[model samples]
Structures are given as C-alpha cells and as structure tokens.
Target chain A: MSPPNALDSARAFVVDDEEAVRESIALLLRSVGIASRCFADARTFMADYHPDDPGCLVLDVRMPRMSGLELQDELNRRGWTLPLIFITGHGDVSMAVEAMQAGAFDFLQKPFKDDDLIRRVQKALEHDRAQRQQRRGLTELQHRYDSLTPREREIAERLVAGESNKVVAIDLGLSERTIELHRAHVMEKMVARGLAQLVQMILQLRGSSRGDR
Target chain B: MSIPPLAPDENPLPAPPAESARTNFASEDRLSALLDAAVDPIVLIDSAGRILRFSRAAERLFGYGSDEVLGRNVKLLMPQAYAQDHDQYIHRYQQTGTPRIIGIGREVTAQRKDGSTFPIDLSVGEFRSGAEQGFVGILRDISERKRQEQELLRSTAELRLIFDNAPTAMSITDIRGHILDANHACQVLLGYQRDDLLQRRYTDLTVDEDRAALVADFLSLNAVDDSFSREVRFRTPDGGVLYALLYAGVVCDIEQRSLLMIVGLIDRSALFAATREADELRDRLVHAGRLGMLGEMVSGIAHEVNQPLTAIANYANAGRRLLQNGLTDAAELVSILDKIGSQADRAGQVIRSLRSLTRKREQLRERLDCNALIEDVSRLMELDLRANGLRLQLKLSPALPPVHGDAVQIQQVVLNLIRNAAEAMQERRGDEFVRVTSSARARAVVEICVSDSGPGLSAEVEDRLFEPFLTTKAEGMGLGLSICKSIVSAHGGELLYRRGERGGAEFVLRLPTATE
Candidate 1:
C-alpha cells in the first residue's frame, strides 16, 4: 500500500463555541497541510456539513451552545458517522474514561502539541476512509444482486449450494442446454469465477448480518 | 297346775331363770347408759316411727328432753317440710320389703327444735320379732366435719388456679422429679406445652449440659433440708432458649411422704436479649465512629500537606529557571529556607485541627438554643454542600428556648446528621436538598428536626436503628446515630424518627429546655 495523504486532502470539521480556540485548532490543522471547515457550535455544524464524505470531527468537551457530547449524540441521531476527537481544558479521568467509552477517537487536553493534534486527526481520517470504502463495496455487491432475474436467482442458490448443472436442471424441470447458460450468468454477475470463490462470498455475507442489527 | 300361787324367790320361781341371766341384762343396760353419756350426739328412733330415746348428747345437739320426744315421731325434730313425708317414707319401706334405709349409714341434714339445721351421720340397724319389725337409727352431728372438708376443697382449687394462671412460670413435680403439672405461663416462658413438659421431669427442661448438675443440686437440697433454687435456661419449642429464675421445694402429704415438688419460674428472656443488643451496638458504633474520624483526619492531612508541596514545587520550578539563566546565588538560598519555615507553620495548623477533633472528654452540659447551634454547623458545611451541588432549606421555629446539653457534643451530632444527608444524595441527580427545622414543643421541651431528599432508611435498619453502629453506607463505620442517641438521651429526652417530605429520612431530637 502507498503512504496515506494529509487530512486536508479529505474533509474535516472543528466545532467549538470559543472562536479563539476554534480558529487556533483550525490553524493547527492547516499548518500540517490539513484543510477544514469550522463551526461555532453543534447547531451550526449540523446545518452546514454533509456526513457522507470521509472526514474527522474536532470538538470541545464543554461549550455554551451544544456541548461536544451533545453534538456526538445529535450526529448519531442523524446517522452521520464521523470519527470524533474531543478537547478539554480541565480533563478529569472519569470524564476522559466516559468520552473514550462513547467511541471518541481521542481526547487532547489544553496546551497540547500541534504535532500531537495533527497525528490523531490523520489517524481518524484514515479510519473514516476505510469504513466508507467497505460500505461502498457492500453497496456495489447489493446492486449486482438486485439486477438478477427470478430464474437467475434459483440458479445462483443452487450454485452456492454446490449443485451441478445436471442436478439443478432436473430440480427446475429445465434442459441441460438452458441450465449451462444460466450457470455462466450466475458466476459472472456474482463476480465469482469458481465454486469455491462463490461459496466464500456467501459466507462473508452471512457473517456480517449482525452489523445490520 | 292352773292355780298354784308361787312365793317370791321360792318354789324355784316356777323353775325360773338363773341369777346370772339377770346380771347379764344389768351389764347390757350399763353399756347403753355409757353410750348415752358420750359427748358426741346420739339418738335412737324405732321402726314404729317413734323416738324411742335421746341421750344428753342429743339434747345438746337438738335442744329437747328425752321424755318429750320418746314414743313421738322423730320427724318432729326435722324441719316442717320433712315431717309429713317421713311417715309415708316409713310406711312405704315396711311394705316394699327392700329395706329402703335400714342397716345403711348416710349423711343428711337435721333440724333442731329451735329451727336450725345441721349436717349429721345416721346409721340404722334392723330387728325382727315374728311379725313386728323395728329399725334402731343412731345419729351423729357432723357440722365440724363438713367445715373441714370445705376448707380443704377451697385450698386445692385456689392452688390449681395460681398454677394455671400465674404470670410467672410455675410447675409441680412428683417425688421422683417428674413434672406432674405446669401453668400456662410456664408454657409461654419455657416455650413448651403441657404435653411436652408432663412426665418429662425437671432434668429434661434444663439444657442437656446442665441436667446432671441440676439433678445433683436437687439431691443436695433433699439431703440438707433446704429448697433448691437457681437461675437457668429452659429450651423452647421454637429453638430459642429462655432465661428463668427457678425455685423448687420438697413438700410432704398427709402420710408424711414426699408427694410433690413445687417449681417456680420467672422468665428473663427479654432482658437478656436486650442486654446483648446493647453490647453489640456499642461495639459497632465505636468502630464506625473511629473509622469516620480517621477519614476526616486524612482529608485534613491531605489539604495541609498539599499546600506545602505546592509551595515546594513552585520554589523548585523558580530555582531551576533562575539557575538555568545563571541568576541563582547564596542569597536566593536564604529566601528558600524562609519559605520552607512558613510552610511548616501551615502544616502545624492542620495538626492542631485534628488534635482538637479527636480529643476525648467527658461531656459537659451547658444552656444554649439547639436551633442556633445547628445553624452554626450548617454554615460551616456550606462550602461542602455547594461543592456537591446541594441546596439547603432552613425552617427553624422562632424563639426556640435554650436546652440543657453539652454544646460541643450536640454540635457534633448536628454535623454528623447533615454530613450523612449530604452523602445520601451524592449519587442522585436533580434538585438535591436538606431541610432543618426546629419547634417549641412544650414549655420545657424543644424539638430539632433534620430531613433529607435521599433514599430513606430501609425497614431493617429502622428496626434495630438506635442499636450502636449499624449503617447502610459501604464505607461507613455506622457509629453516627448511636452516638447521637447517646447525646440525646443524656439530655433527658428522646430522639424520634419519621419519613421526610421528599421520601427520605427524618430525625427529630427532643431535649428538655433550660428553666428560665
């Protein structure tokens, strides 16, 4: 694999009610070749941003208008799955424990190094990119399956079940000549070149069912 | 032969009876006279329904002369109600041939000629002469005998009633020591039933370990001629043992035989249980109070130590910076030592505070308004309340009279109550509050009420509440309330409990107000 690029190559959002702290964080991200949008609080971030892009969030733990935890909650409510990093001036161990437990990427105490901040931001961006790519791959597989005809679906089930052309045609009351044609269509549409490969694909799909729940 | 005139004591008295026969008749008459002269009342009535004779004894008993009643109806000596029936009774007996009352002795009522009735025993004998039949009835007055019998019956009944209903347990046993009877109180006190105790013997009621020793004591008592008495435990049916003061005695019946042993029982079960509870409570309270005092002292130590350490850190940081810049010298070292001395003074102040708190002393009483003392403690804890995000409501009644008590001791109680209230509400969210109220109870009484908005005391804790150091807190030593109870009781009053308005705990302290 090639080396990953800076966070600015992707997208980033900084949400804090303190304009000074917000601008300083934005500047810190820029100094490291990362680009970002800034919001004064959670409300402005909600109205302005699109979540589908691969990005990381920089948030302040305490804010007068919509705190960082509340913003995390609102983003979850809206199904905007961004990796969140929190910043606090007076960080207690329990509060830190709680924020980490809630899936926060990292927490940076005040007066932290600009280098340290950028390192975590880059890491969070990469995680976001990987998750988005996986979801895209799933969607492409879903689209391919949706294009199949009813007759093609029956052929595919039997193929996954390790049935031969002769047995499948006998079960469906079709001739072997027509069965061979549908068999080629099942492999090509499912992007599986062999019986082993097709079975592996079905197994992968079945194991990931819990992620839906 | 038809007309021979015999001379007196001549012609052999027609070959008459011998002289010895006449002598025998005279002796029989003398014996009859002796019977008549006896002190006991005697009367003879013939079967012909006639009073044949009555002795001087009978005269004293019936108040009548022998001639007056001789050959007269004996029924005349009876009451008017019995006289008319007497003749019919005699006539019916002579016809039935079954001899209704003849030859039988029985007790019945007799009436004197003066109209007084007394009990008597009458025995009858039957005589027959061809067709003439007769009954000889002998009468003995028995008024004294009846009185003696009644006295004996009353004593027996009264003793039985006492055994059955005595508030203290009691039992009776035979000479062999087996229980013959037990009272209801004995059943409740020993936790046994009448069936369980009967024939079981005194040794069985005692705990097995003590049975042999108790039997030996009883034997010793019999030998020395003293009653056997001791305090012992009798096992109960429900498996709880009871404490009792027991007493046993050797008693003899009319035949001079050891027929019964009287056992008296006085239960001390409640007193013993209460004493045990008191001891356990005192131990727990002391332990908990010591732990709590240790915790407070540690916190104070931390605060005191932290200030000096902070100063040391500042000094070190400053000295390092100065030395790095080449500005430190011997003069700067002198100032550092002075700073250390000042920090030592601050530490000293902390030790004194701890010393004052942990110092023990006999409580000294004074006159002061309990309401005012509570307010002072509350103000002292104001910062702690704010730090924990709690609010306070003071509803002290106006002009609360001064109470006689140890001010410092009562102050300690108030502080502990407030601190407990604060701790109970620590984990809960939303408007947490503690309210203190005071009221003028009566002319000589004052009540101080403390209530909190935390979860209330559980029912289990409430029951054994005043018993020393029982506590619901995980880290608590459980001594706070017990000490509070001690302090309140010392003031000649009571500490009462109730549920707070916000579904929590409420404690009220009632103290005797100081005289004006």
Candidate 2:
C-alpha cells in the first residue's frame, strides 16, 4: 500500500468487543475510501492510540473490562482531542446522552443501518479535522501575540475590546498619533489585515479557550 | 359341680356310732370349729326355707353376726326376685321329695346385710337333724374374676370392629404363604370374598412378576425378625392390576413362636393415576412458560436475527462499491461472500433456538456437558441482553460433571431467569451485567448460578418469587420463576436465590450430578 497522505491518513479507529460488528464497521468505512483500524477491545485500542492521530473513534459503549465510556474519560484525562463516535445498544439511551454530554461527537445504536453509522463516523471525523486545524491556528496566533511589546499589547487589547485609537489614547493619557502607532505595530505583530480581523481573531481565541474549559 | 356333703366321713364326729356321751359331745364341738374355719359361708335352712344354722364364715361374708341371723328366713340372703322364687322351690322340693341343688353347685347373686349384691359360687345339700329335714348352704364371692371375663370380651369385640372396617387391606397368612384369615378390606382390594381369599395362596393374589418375590418375602420373615416393606402389584380377581405397598412381618404366638405372617397393604393406584395427570399438566405449563418468555424477548430476538441481515446487506453494499470502482480483488470478494454466508448461518441458529422454545414436546433425559448448555443459552440471550443494556458473561467450568435432563426444559429455565434479571434491572442505570456460571458444588451436586448487577431482591420478593401470581413489575405475570423452580424440582434439583455480592439478585440451581 502507498504511504498515507494528509487526507488518506485520516482514519476511523473502530473498537468493539464484538468481532463481527467491529469488522463490519471497518468494512463500511473502507467502502467509502476511509482508512480504518479495528481493535477487539478498548484496552488494545488505548495501547495503540496517539494524541496526534488524525481520526475519530467508533467505540462500543459497553464492554467486559474497560468500556468505551471509561476509555473516553481516560483519553480526556490524557488531553487527547479525538472526536468519539459511540455504538450503543438498544436500551442505552441514557448512556448515549451521558456520553454526548461528556463531549462525545455522537452515538449510534446496534443493528443500525450501514449508511447511518457511516454518516455519523464521517461527521465525527470532520469535527476532528476542524478541531485540529483550529488548534494549529490558535498556536500560531499565540506565538505572534507573545512577540508584541507591553505597550503594543495593551493597545491591541483595548482595540479588540471596541476602543478606537483615539479612545485608547485618551484612556492611557497618550497622544492620538502615538496610540495609532502602537496599534499599527500590534496589528502587524498579530498578523491581522485590519481592525475587524484583529478583533475577530481575538474573539476566536477566547471562544476556543472557553471550549477547553 | 358337686356340692359339699354335710354328713360325710370328714364330719369330725366320733368314729364309732356308739361313742361315750362326753366324747360324742367333744366331737360335736370340734365339728363346729371345723365348720367355722371353712372359707366358704355355710348356712342351714328348714324345709320352709327358714334359717336354722349360721357359721362364722357366713357371718363375715354376709356382713351379719351368727346370733343376729339365727332365726332369720333364708330369703333374706337373696335378692327380692330370687327370694320369692327360693321359698316356692324349697317347698316344692320338700313335698315332692325331689332334691334340687342338694348336691349341685351354681353361681348366684346373693344380697349382703348392707344391701350390696355380689356374684358367688353357691352349693346346697340336705341333712337330717333329729327328724328336722333342713339344708346347708355354702357360697364363695367371685366378683373380681367375673369383671375380668367381661373386660376380655369387650376387647375382643373392639378388635373385630377394627379388623372389619380398616381402610388398609390386611390379612394373616401362614408361614407357607397360605391365607389363613383376611379382613373385609383385603377382600375388597383383591375383588374377592373372604372365603375366596382364604382358598387362595398369598402368591396367587400377586402379579406373576411379583409372586416369586412374595414367596421370598414370606420365607424371609421365617427368621422371626423385623418387618419388611415393599411396593408390588397385586392381581385382582377381575384381572386388573392393583399397586400396593406391603408391610409384612411374622406374628408370634404366646409361646414366642412364629405363627403367621401378618401383611398390611396400602393401595396406591389412585396416587399413581393422580401423578400421571399432574405430569401431563406440568408439561403443558412448561410449554406455556416458553411461549411467555418468547413473547417477552421477541423484539430483542428480532434485533439479533436482524443483525446478521444487516451485516449481509452491508457486505453486499461494500462488495458492490468495490466492483463498480474496478477494484475487484477476487480474493476480497470471496472472503466477503464467506462472511455473508456465516451471517446467514448465525441468523438461522437464532431461529432454530426459537423454534425449540416454541414447540410443544415431551420431556426427555440426555447426558450433556453443562458448559455446552450454558454456552447455548448464553448465545440465545445475547441479543436480548444487548437490547436492554445488560452484558452477558459465561463462566462455565470445562470439566463439570454431565447432567442428565431434558435439554429444552433446562434451556427454558435459564433463558427465563436471565430475562427476568433483565427486567429487574431495566429501571436502574449503570453497568448492568448478567453473569451465568456453572461449577461443582459437591461430588453429587452441580450448581448453576445466575447473577445480575441490578438492585438486589428484598426478602419478601425472594420468598414469593417462585409463587404463582407474584410479580414486582407491572407487566410481569410472574410465571417465569415459578415454572423454573418446577422444572428444576422435577429433575431432582433445587432452584433458590439470594442477594449477590454486587448488590444484585443471584439465583442458584442445583441438580444431582449424573455419571457419564
């Protein structure tokens, strides 16, 4: 097989104690040109999992030793951000709700249709991709934001808080031209094309940080 | 009996008829002493039945002094009825010169001085005292002996009553197996008359297969030892068979020698008929229980069978996708086909188990591995448990002793209980699992334990779980545990339950282990 590329490498790790079920899910994913790996149980999947893997997890909610819910909690404690798609049984509505509330991407009941499960897995993978891209973007923003001097950083915070350059000059007891110069430097260091762009980037950082919390 | 003669040779008088006057008088005094010393009361009466003489013994016996009764009429010593008849009899005897009771003894009731009457042995004799013809009487009280004789008669009558009316058949047979005497019940049991039974031998009443055993049992009792009990079929006169339990032993005589074999027969034909009827009813109940369980598990079973269908469809879909894309790895297509075939087989297996549960059939015993049976039921219940969010775990011991039982009935019991556990935990939230395990309890017993991780049972529920019409759930009819217990008990096993370690209900069934 050829080496995995950026898009091809994105996989769905299907973990279920039931062999036939897990294998059927993997095959379903493969039918849609999505690469997938199957694990007999949560423990084996945990041993093989990497935080940087570009994928989602299709996990059976209930298992003998370590259940999928428990594995989800463990992965969360280890700071892994892979989107989780759970496979629950018929009478497991409450468990599904709990899993979703715990930040799982979604859940599918057993004996679910092939397309149903495939669609859920696809959505979960898309969510995982979006999250990874956002994390990268946030890291780059943090690097640039950390490069600003204290005066420029203060002016940038005021501008993003809806204070114009003249208002920031009044609040900080500086000349309007000086405040404008500091705001220009802040915009250049933070890599924003305009005043609105700078404010929107800061808003995204706040939103992302709140999501982690 | 002969009466005592008054003028006999032992009168204590002088030997010679012509004795000296003084000696004759002395002889008379000695004769009086001898008469006074007699244990029997003696009295002399005239021809008119007048009292003439009374001895000291008579005074003590009559409760009167000799002086007080010297001239009293002899009628005073008899009851009113006898007193009236006595004087007439004595007058007739004197006139006719025909002695009545002169030398004969008879038992008569005499009145004492205090008016109490007692039975006595009475004898009277005639004697000539200086041309005065009179009578001497002697009497002995015999009340105690008479009362004892009456008691013996009453006891014999009571025995006859019991022997005639007892429900159980009974007979007395000689050591050689001859029927000596039989009660009415025995006649009814054998459908024959008492005379007919007496004419036949004990073995003649027994079935052909048991006749020899009957003779052997008779001879066995010849040792004059303990009684023996046996179940045998007796052949009645009309040729019908009578099932009976016989308790027989030797009846010894007063000399401590074996005289006869007394046999008691308990007729059990009615009980046999009733048991067969009950067995038929139980079989119907077992079928009904299976149907009920199927009703409860229908949706889950459908889902289980539907799984394989779903898998087969998915495999076909994937195979189609591959072929349309011109990526036909022929080997991959073949493998997918094989998987589809296996899935069909899996669904077929589920249907087969369902058919067994639904069919009405007779019970049969077979030697089976307990582990294999556990695995079979576990598979049957897997989809149902999955639907209810309950996990199924099987911990079957590999080398467990084989059990001889009806496979379908046993499977019904296991599946019913597991489903019951599912319903019990339906309301609870958490990791719910039903774990079934088989192990050896002892050399003679094997136990199957079904435990669940739901709310444990309360004492009242545990006590009533096996009772008909008892249920903790609104939809439950409560026949599951009752039928399970019946099936287990019919196999000589016990079904019991208790609170488990994981705060859930645990049911344990113990069946007698059979040797392979």
The CA lDDT of each predicted structure is 0.70, 0.77
Please write out the lDDT profile of model 2 over residues A1-213, one tens digit for every residue.
Answer: 223355546899988876777787777677777789999899999899888888999998888799989999998889898989988774677899999999999888766877787788778877888888888899899788889998888888888888877888898999999998888788888889999999888888778779779
Task: Give the runs in model 2 whose Cα sits over 4 Å from its true position.
Answer: A1-10, A13-33, A37-107, A113-116, A119-213, B1-26, B44-53, B63-106, B112-116, B123-137, B162-202, B223-225, B237-239, B254-262, B285-305, B308-516
Q: Which stretches in model 1 have alpha-carbon errors above 4 Å?
A: A1-213, B1-38, B79-104, B127-133, B191-196, B206-221, B224-231, B238-240, B291-328, B331-516
lDDT per residue for candidate 1 within B1-516, as digits (tens), equals 000000111111121122322233335577468757777665544454555456778887888877677656677777666665676666566555555455666776788878888878776666443332345556777788989998889998998887688787788777677888889988777777799889987777778777787888677655213687877877777886778778888777558756577788877777788889788767645644654464464443553454454344434444454455555576875675566566666757765555455344335667897877877767666767988899878898888888887776777777778887888897877888888888988657888888899898888888987774366775454556766776677668788788887789898888899875
Error of 2 at A193 (Å): 26
Retained native contacts per candidate, as fractions?
A: 0.00, 0.33
- How is the predicted docking of candidate 2 categorized under the CAPRI scheme? incorrect
DockQ of 1: 0.01
Most accurate candidate by DockQ = 2
